[model samples]
Target: GAGVSQSPSNKVTEKGKDVELRCDPISGHTALYWYRQSLGQGLEFLIYFQGNSAPDKSGLPSDRFSAERTGGSVSTLTIQRTQQEDSAVYLCASSTRTITGAVEAFFGQGTRLTVV
Candidate 1:
């Protein structure tokens, strides 16, 4: 894709339901990451994937949250039994090399999830 893409820019779900957010990273990027940010809060790392290996899931709040990257590109974040506290914007980023000290990340617009 020309840039990182995310689906369902806005999601509103009832408590205890499930919601799935998707991301499509830029072409040929080898690293991908997921982060969550609450209203007026900083971004919180959720997971990181370097390639075909297992994603670093340490950032997931609990077993209720999970994500997977398929074919080293697209990723999906699934939140099970959503709660009001889970409301936030989910962001995805991809990294690529650049000039010395100039490497930066590209971010998607993000999925705004609201659990009522």
Candidate 2:
């Protein structure tokens, strides 16, 4: 893909139902991240996958949310037993790692999830 791509721009689901969000990062990018933003809250880090290293899942809000990046490319975020508080815009970003320091990251339009 030319840039980070996410599916299901909008989602409306009943409480307790599970939802799966998908992301396709740019080619050659080694780092991918998942973030959550509420109505007024800042981007909350959820997870990170870099190359072949183990994913950094420290930022996940709870065990109900989990993500995985396969073959160092596409990624998926799954939320189980969704709750009303889970309603928000889920954002995905991908960046090319450089030797010196941080590099620019490309973000997807995000998936707006409304838990009814």
Candidate 3:
């Protein structure tokens, strides 16, 4: 894809249902990130994967949330036994490091998940 892309732009599910959100990062970007934004809130980092390093999962809010990047291009975020509080817009971003070790990221329009 030319840019970061996410699937199911909008999703509505009953409380307790499970949902999976997908992200396709831009080609050649080795660093991928997942963040969650509650209504009227700022983005909260959920997880991050860079190259072959172990993913940084410290940002996940709970055991119910998990994410994985396969082949370092596609990523999926799974929310198991979703709760109403889990409703949010999930955002994905990808970036490549600069020679100076800075990161420049491109973000996808988030997948809005609503748990009713």
- Candidate 2 lDDT tens digits, 4-114: 899999999999999999999999999999999999889999998997454588999999998888899999999999999999999999999899855999999999999
Per-residue lDDT over 47-112 for candidate 3, one digit per residue giving the tens place of the 0 to 100 score: 988863535889999999988888978989999999999999999999997777648889999999
**Candidate 3 off by > 4 Å:** none
Candidate 3, residue 14: how far the Cα is off, in Å: 1.0
* Candidate 2 residue pairs in clash (backbone atoms < 3 Å): none
Best by TM-score: 2
Q: Sort by lDDT, best first.
A: 2, 3, 1
Give the RMSD in angstroms, all C-alphas superposed, for model 2.
1.1
The alpha-carbon lDDT assigned to residue 19 of candidate 3 equals: 96
lDDT of each residue in 17-116, candidate 1, tens digit only: 9999999988987788899999999999999887655447899999999888889878899999999999999999887644552247899999999998
User: Where in model 1 is the C-alpha error above 4 Å?
Assistant: 97-102
Off by over 4 Å in 2: none
lDDT score for residue 36 of model 3: 94
Error of 3 at 36 (Å): 0.6
